[model samples]
Target: MAKTTTASKEGMAIRTKREIIKLLKQEGALDALQLAKLLGLTGMAVRQHLYNLQEERLVAFEEEARPMGRPAKMWRLTPEANRLFPDGHADLLVSMIESMREAFEEEGLEKMLEIRNRKQIIQYLSKAPSDLPLKEQLEALAHARTAEGYMAEVIDNVDGSYSFVEKHCPICEAAKVCSGLCSKELEMIQQVLGEDVDVERKSHMLTNSNRCVYSIKPKGSAVL
Candidate 1:
């Protein structure tokens, strides 16, 4: 039937976009020509898919300067694209947290959260620049978080502060079961960024927002 054919075509489009996302995630970036070659499709076909992905804000492109000739266009997955991938074992994690809460009580949950926060801070600090300015350090933190599938970015505020925005939360499923997970994450960021900077959760996805935003400014400084 006509309806069945339309559904089939939509399914194919979904599968093709999945393939494109997989390629981009694995290879980091690729041009339309390279993607077409990988997909065994024409460059124009690949570009059409890329256009749709871009419109959805799932993919982004950049220009790479070549040694000779003009800059080549390269496509890659945006942080929002991370939502398409399977999470870092969300089901298993949520179950474990629930069990901990039921068996060991609230104090035990707090201890577990603290331990997890320490580990995350150590991991992020290992890659984040220690000698950079607060803003630069925040940028590095965003990069580290994005690499871990958080889909984070840094925005400069007009009031001489910066906003750290995470468009996607890979562990949202886990955080929903254990509220401590979210609070500890904010604590971890504060610890990693140092005492000189104050980090405030301006917006939270758990509280009905589409994304999480952290307002960062120097200690004892008012928003200008």
Candidate 2:
């Protein structure tokens, strides 16, 4: 007979919590029942973990209306939980931007933004080629963005259009100080997708939306 060892309670709890966070990041707000179904755990068990996370201010819940009854509690990661994900040295990046602004003013800052965009365009183009189908290009671009801590994904509209969503922005703090950083990202995407493709910023986190959503479709068609 083979003997099997079970994970320690503490270790299991930690891993489960991380999984919960990962699911929420990928799928957005979900109720305990949804989470339980996804994680294959009892709803009670998931609720316990969620309550614990709520106490830590890592997660929060809002009442979401359902057609049948009272609103269900939909849970999501709090902004504080952003620290648990890769941040790409947010503080240092913000500091560098501030220092550059002090030394060079708006003109110098704009120049730096251009330089950074050129480099990012090169890197992004290598991953996502315009020749590929639009869906394939988005997947490649999302992969590259996720690798850089953007937590990006592509959403199929099923009507010959797609949505490029970035759930979290690792350099959000830096972007806040330098709006050009935000605009240049769109430029990079435009350059990668080529002129026939239309990439529009539908929603932005800086505008108080939960995430950044870009409407992408071929030119000469409505953005359904």
Candidate 3:
């Protein structure tokens, strides 16, 4: 068996830190004890990583009030931590969009986006199951987005609807340069999800939020 060297141990620590960040990103907030449980590590080990992340300004914590002795510390990712995820050649995409606009004007640029939107709709439709339950269909949609570096997931809402959330937008910069890209995403999602359901944009990433959320449900009925 290969002996673990100092460098290898250090590498494991680094990987643990990243895993902590991913968990926080997906689950929103968690206490050190909770993180330790989920990661199969001791609380002390988790807290050490959390403190390092805090010092790096990649993570922060707020105290949650408890009825018992002491309040619990709930850790969450800081906005700066968003850099760790992929942005899908954001700078290059943004430059290409600007070049297209300058060469062809707004109308031509919109036309190009429309073509891209049509392709995107077809791609999503090809993967998302039309015959499954609305929630399961949304799960498939989320899986497709995740494969495209969107870090997407579906959540069950209390009001009988599903929330499809994209934690990271790989084309965020490009989307900002061309608002139609953002609208097209919504339009494509609506079309791909089928006419039997309604998809509503709830939160937007460009509006100071780090995530985009959409409320989806069957038309004139609950999802489940």
Candidate 4:
């Protein structure tokens, strides 16, 4: 039937998109021509699929300049695309948390969180320059957080403050069960940034938002 044919075509498109995502994840970035050659499809077909994926915000492209000729556009998976990949670590984290809770109870969980916070502070402090201005310190903190899979960014406010936005949380699965982990993270951020700045959670992923946002302001200053 005509309807059945249309449905089949749609299903094929979905399968093709999944294949493209998988390829990007495994091989990093590739051009449409490269992807077409690998999939045995025409360049036009691969490009069409890439277009759809881009509209969905799962894929992105960067222009890479070569020694000669026009720059080649390389396609890559965006942070949103990361959710499609299997999180093997999530299962391991949950298992570890359960074991700790069973062996040491609530106090054990608290201790684990405390140790994590202390270690995180030390790690971040080692990378964050103490002599930089407040804004630069926030930028350094954002870079460190991004390296740790938080996908964090620093946004400057007009009033001389910053907004720390984390578009992705790698430990969401663990945080669902152990929310104290999130609390410790906030405490660590405040402690590491110094005593003159205040950090407040403006938005949270646990409340169903897609990202977490922290409003950073100077102490004794008006809220941003």
Ten residues in a row with the worst lDDT in model 4?
Answer: 79-88
Q: Report the lDDT tens digits of candidate 2 across residue range 1-224.
A: 12223446767888889999999887889999999999999999999999999999999999988999999999998888888878779899999999999999999999999999899888888899778888899999999999998889999896779999999888888888889999998898888898998889998978876689998999986644
Please report, in order, the local distance difference test score of every candidate based on alpha carbons: 0.86, 0.89, 0.89, 0.85
Q: Higher-lDDT candidate among 1 and 3?
A: 3
**Superposition error at 57 for model 4 (Å):** 13
Residue 210 local lDDT, model 3: 57
Candidate 3: worst 10 consecutive residues by lDDT?
A: 1-10
Model 3 CA lDDT for position 15: 96
Give the runs in model 1 whose Cα sits over 4 Å from its true position.
Answer: 1-86
lDDT of 3 by residue, 1-224 (tens): 25668779889999999999999888878999999999999999999999999999999998999999799999998878877888898889999999999999999999998999899888877788687778877888899999999999999888888899998888988988899999989988988888887889999988966589998888898444
Off by over 4 Å in 3: 1-5, 69-71, 222-224
Query: What does the lDDT come to for candidate 1?
Result: 0.86
Candidate 2 TM-score to native: 0.92
What does candidate 4's lDDT look like per residue over 1-224, in tens digits?
Answer: 99999999999999999999878765668999999998889999999999999999999899999799999889988767767744438778988998999999989999999998999889988888667887788889889987777767888888877898886678888888889988988899898888888889988878865568898888998743
Residue-by-residue lDDT tens digits, candidate 1, 1-224: 99999999999989998899878765567999999999999999889999999999999899999899999889987767756765768889999988998999989999988888888888988878556888888889999988887778898988989999986677888988888889988998999988888889998978855578999989987777
